[model samples]
Target: MSATEQPVHDHSTAALDHGRRGSLGQIVSWCLWDFGSNAYNTVILSFVFSVYVTTAAAPDEQTGQQVFANMQTVAGIIVALLAPVIGVWADRVRRRRLMLSVSTLLVVASVSMCWFVLPYETHHGLKYLYLGAGLIALANMMQQVAEIFYNSMLVDISTPSNVGRISGAAWGLGYLGGVITLAATLALFVLDGGFLGVPEQDAMNYRAIAVFCAGWLLVMSVPVMIWGPPAPPAKGDARTLNVVSAYAQVFRHLRRKFRTSPQVLGFLVASAVYRDGLSAVFAFAGVIAATSYGMDTTEIIIFGLAANFAAALGAWVFGLVDDRVGPRFVILASLATMVVFGGLILAISATAMFWIGGLGISSLVGPVQSASRTLLTRVIEPGEENEMFGLYNTVGRAASWIAPGLIGIFTALLGTRLGLLGIVLTLLGGLILFWFVRIEGVTHNRSRVTSAA
Candidate 1:
């Protein structure tokens, strides 16, 4: 342990009593939550439902895209405001499971409601578009809020020696789930009206997919709810904090952390910056492929599937490396490599080069994400896990506009391909910031305690 690192406390509550750190069942159950969550993250939010809302539900393509973007911006602001307060409440009452359950169910409900968003050709109104947008935005927000509790659980399920690989496995599972779900969607619904032969008259295929996503999430959520450890006993009463009080408490916590452990805050900010860059890389890679490489929609989808596979593979491999070495080393190496790959994609115009560079950057991204989560889990003090993760999400959403904004500016000034420089710059900036983040060592078997998952 580092000289400045404080001793971590162990919780002996029945809900947290884990034999052998955490059983394989417990760990696998935790990972399945990620797999199930891909229904929302991959299908509804990223690929299928969003595309339907923008292109079919709305009156026109431009209007649909604009309205959906605005709704997401609003959702992002609300999440930033609410995440910390919810985290604080969950920790105070020791009701992480209850909170997680409520949020997850809410997400399910929101996604299921997406079934009502009929295409304009069938419904002939703006209401459907607005309804679809609203439901998706709600689902997105609740999903993120659910993640606060979900991420806090990571500490409970793994030891310091294995947290890296566990986190990596979970992330890899999510990417794999996304790939499978997306491919299934294409094969079963979107391609040639699908083999199911669900009539295309009113866009029933997409609506059915929404219902499927809801069921997928609900069913997938059951394992963790049943087998996962319950929250530990509260330290005190469960008085809830209002918005003002919650923000005040969060600020006070940040101030104290800054004074006592500046690296905590440093990692939060640094990870937020680079994470945004990672998101942009995934978001814009399709755009580059279409515009620069002249890849058609079918080709783009195939590339996306391949990219997810690469990311999944990288997460699994680097996760083992993380356990042997440390998350800091994994994160630094991944981010540095990503910066170089992003530059290569920007500089090279060949189709083969785009495939190589795009997949290279994609592979690096999952490791960085997994390593970042692992590092945060290791660094936080014993009891403040939920609140710290809430801050992690908030800071991340707060800076969410950087990469997109930079991409917009650079694209306007230069061209489409050169706009990728913004992504490279954002990543380089994060790498520099992360270089200064010190991971205080902890005694693996002594002070580090089994927490939540």
Candidate 2:
């Protein structure tokens, strides 16, 4: 198990053998986690619940935004603090399934709380909102950590040659899952108006969606728990570190790895900026449509479905490009596309070209972002995949505070449309920085295999 010794799983062989084994099924199940988790993102965090809390529950839009922002800030801080430690623990214990189960359950419980969010019950709204926000944050953090382990399992399942395809498939499947779940929820609750006599606007309807998400997550996860191979325990003599010690080890590992390879560090920093911009796209899309374009709930849902569908398409199409050209090229291409479309969104906002331009931009944004993720997967080491992704989430969390905060600030000073310009700036800056990065080392690392299992 020494660094030089080829571990049981050789990177190249695993990558090649990925799909040959039960890789396809395992990868699909793994991606389903994203699908199920995004139910929360789509319904609760991004579109529906956010609007409900800010507009319906809070006294005013300003207060609602403040509350939401504060919750995110707290969540970001907590995630930033704990993620690396959890990652280290996962690597040490090689017990990803247990962690995934715990995290998913928390999400289900928290999301179900949405049932308590009655519009007339404004006094209780704040308390519930705060509680929900905390749960959401914790769930999100746990989900992210589980995702790292899930993705790391990819190396165990697939070979180097098909890693890009597997990664792309996982991502595409995730979007597909989101599309299906969202469509079902929308059809059941919003369009059909009542599941078993529960009105769409009633808390029960929303609760149904939460229940569906929770069930979906739990059910889909069973395959991985049952069929996916378990990671072997850390080698003999490897000491288990506590949370504080784990954090210290993470920082030390970061320094050692980054110092040995500056390119990885550069890629990480650049990816952080762009990833935040990518997140902002989904996070604020509904807000922009609602406030700026006068989009109602139905329109927002339509937009989300369309965007997710486009993302699925993008993942498939750009996946080929990622494998053929190289991850760096695909990443740059995606980022460039995002910048163009994001800028177009800002331009079309003040014109009669709202839906025309908006939909066009929306269409491209999904594929471009999906492509970027595929590219990121191409650029990192296999053994270090989870830790790298953990940092990816960390940098993303750190940058998370900026875009939303800036949007609010700019909106307060300028206008909503103008406020969105910050998003464009972030994307463009990330794209530019990416151009200067050297990817040769990463390419070499990805090509090498150190595992033997």
Q: Tell me the whole-model lDDT of each prediction, alpha carbons only.
A: 0.82, 0.65
- Candidate 2 structure quality by residue, lDDT tens digits, 1-453: 677763232112312333443456676666666666667767767766667666666666777777777776777787777777777777776676676666666667666655665553535446655655555565666666666666666656655455566667666666677778778777877675745556645455765666667677777767776666566456554566698888787788788756555665676778778777778888888888878888888888888887777777777676666565556666777777666766776766553455555554544454545544544554445345556667767777777766766787889899987788777788787788777876442333443333322
Candidate 1 stretches with Cα past 4 Å from truth are 1-20, 442-453
Q: Write the per-residue lDDT of candidate 1 for residues 1-453, one digit (tens) a residue.
A: 999877543322222223326678888988998988987877787656887888899889889978888898999999998889988877777888778888999999999999888998778888898899999999999999989999988888887668888999999998898788878878887788887777787898988889888998898888887787676666766677777887888889999887767767888999999999998887777767776678875687688888888998999999998877777788889999988887887777777888898889889888999988887877766667789899999999998999988988998899888888889999999999989876445213322333332
TM-score of 1: 0.91
In model 1, which range of ten residues has the least summed lDDT? 11-20
- Candidate 2: regions farther than 4 A off: 1-22, 122-125, 200-202, 350-383, 441-453
- Candidate 2, residue 75: lDDT: 70
Structural similarity to truth (TM-score) of each candidate: 0.91, 0.86
